[model samples]
Target: MQRTPNWSLQQLPDMDMGQFRQWQALLEERTGVCVSDQRKTFLQTSLCARMREQQMDDYQTYYDYVTQGPLGAIEWSALIERLTVRETSFMRHRASFDCVARYLHERLSQPGRQTPLQLWSVGCASGEEAYSLAIVVEQALIDTGSSKRDYGIWATDISLQALEQGRAAHYPTGRLGGLTQAERNTWLTDTPDGRHAVLPSLRERVCFSRMNILELAQAPLRDLDIIFCQNLLIYFRRWRRRDLLNLLAKRLAPGGMLVVGLGEIVDWNNPLLERVPDDRVQAYVRRDSSESLE
Candidate 1:
């Protein structure tokens, strides 16, 4: 739409007719995501590089080549990698941590098995959400005489490259402004300037990897107790949303919990989930999940 000649490898210009629609359909079919009309130009701009790399003139050909050609899998991976946004920051939506802490407090107070608390941060961008959850877990550790239950954190994203950035746990100083000086002292290694490195022990607490919600059906998440699939549904269409909700519901453990972003209301009424309160922080609990912060 902008008709800019110069573009990045990810930006595609002079879009071929039906090209956007073709890719849109493929995205929907493959990922259950729909590229809104307003965002179409953005996708085009983002995909120019793939076009250039593949030596293609327009999107239709690119889509065909990317989907059905021998190198289709690689191109498709790149397509999904570039199109899906992964912007995130430390302590994104502070309220979520309070909710997690509250849930853990109430759950652990009761008679429960002493296994590592399993938590998932789906669509976790740059690993901040997982680390933020680690902060909560570290705070929630009981000071009892001999309590040493492990805490497990899995941070997953669609972008393999982004996962690399997250696994490194390296962040610029300015982006860490949200941490108090004292908090930084505890959670990070202070550098000469404001920059800090997340403590290696804390970094070791998280496992970052690549995953696809589209592949949720075949993926195994049988033992997960809490899932944070935040701000991820906005990319998808309705039928796809319903399909994903079904998979999300099925993947959750009987008493596990699902914590989506605040105000995300795609399939809230799905029979598999029930609305619950963690003090004032609202989230969905699996219908049979008995875990609660009372």
Candidate 2:
């Protein structure tokens, strides 16, 4: 009987400059994530981890295997989950959420607002951001006396693994520190396993889906009232970042809001988007049709 190799003890081969470039090109082409020289070790470790599981010893051979047919496509999907960064937490950026809360208050205050709010949480990892948004929106509705207003949140990410976690809506108690006692009592329930689960009512309002940011043009979402796309654009090249922002801007409803990470992109101006002029947050509002005409 042939014994299986002990991958845990085996040393992974060092990824040479040429091999790194090939993998880099492939990642950029497939996902628009540009791996820099400083991140070579990060890329190597991520690739070697997957390679070891397949019992593949050579980088070039593994690269070829990942670029071929149906199997390659499936392998690529697994590989991307390892490569992409999914670090996130509830209310990670308080200022950004505060900005969103203010926007919701103003919008909900407007009379004769009959349509349900449509919000998107782009690159929402493990549902924290999406759930946090729900908390803010729910509070805003109640505070503004619009508790009967309808709304829905679309949470999307490229990693199906992350999306699965989002749908599960269960998080360790440590991750719930950001929630105030009142908020926690209102929105979360304790699980027997010591984790906190999102209450059913809030969970029902969030829809999780897998989406590759590179295929934004093919996305069916349009006329969105608010889009939270934070901590996601830093992976792409500068030009690609601009292109992604432009696509997001086009999807916003007139007078809608788009909030991005502070200092993620500079000198990126869109004719249809006007900066919100709040130094505390990096946000923009879509110019109303009549305002654009003027």
Candidate 3:
């Protein structure tokens, strides 16, 4: 009897510079993510893993297969999911969330503020950031004696697999380190399988959607009260990063805050946004029309 080959153990041939460039261009064109020369091995490994699963041995053939027609589109989705990184945790950046809490306090203090606050979490992986935002908003409302205030969080990512995980709102116990004991007690319920699941009260406030960063211009979210886009721009070219920030600026409501990962972009400015001048966080606020006229 003939032996079936163990594709998992099969050695993938080295990807040459030409092949690397082709794959790199395809990723950037489709996802706005730049794969650097240093990440060549990473790109190769991801491609090889997917190629092995597809029983494809040739690089160019697999590349063509991912770019062709309807079947190619499905394959591309799987390939892109492998390429994207989804590492995240609840309240990953404390200072940034602190900034958000402060902003919420001020907004809630305003007279006749909007009934429901709108928040967006760009590149939200597995829903941690979105749920964290929900926690902050809910706490702020309670502290300010505005418990009846309504709010919504829009969490978006490019990977469908990640979005599904976000929708599930279940996480391993190890991933809850960023949450305080009180927070965990309030927002999480113990799962039978040694995991923590976000309580439905928080989950219902967030809507997870698959969104390609390059296609933000067409997204219908507008006048958002806050936009948290962190640890995402590092994968894109500087120009594309600036372009994405500009589009985000357009989506912010006047006086709305935008937070990004520090050092992600340099010398970037938007006419409608003013730097928040907080040393602890890289953030900006959309200028109110009255402030812009001054």
Better of 1 and 2 by lDDT: 2
**Superposition error at 75 for model 2 (Å):** 0.9
Model 3 root-mean-square deviation: 2.8
For model 2, residues 1-294, the per-residue Cα lDDT tens digits are: 122355578655778899999999999999999999999989988987888788787888888888999998999999999999577888888899999999999999998998999999999978899999999999999999885849999999999999999899999977775678899899999999998999888999999999999999989998889999999999999999999999999999999999999999999999899999899899999988713221
Query: What local distance difference test score does each model get?
Result: 0.71, 0.90, 0.89
TM-score quality measure for candidate 3: 0.95
Q: What is the lDDT of residue 260 in candidate 1?
A: 71
In model 1, the Cα lDDT at residue 35 comes to 80
**Tens-digit per-residue lDDT, 1-294, candidate 1:** 123344544334555547777777777887766887777777776777556565565666666677776678887887777777667777777677677667677656657567677888888877878887887777777533228747788888888877887887777865564455665678888667655678887888899878887887776665667887777876776566667666676666666677777655543566777777554454766766433221
Give per-residue CA lDDT, model 3, range 192-246, as digits (tens). 9989999999999999999999999899998889999999999999999999999
Off by over 4 Å in 3: 1-10, 290-294
> Which regions in candidate 2 have their CA more than 4 angstroms from the true location?
1-10, 290-294
Worst 10 residues of 1 by lDDT: 1-10
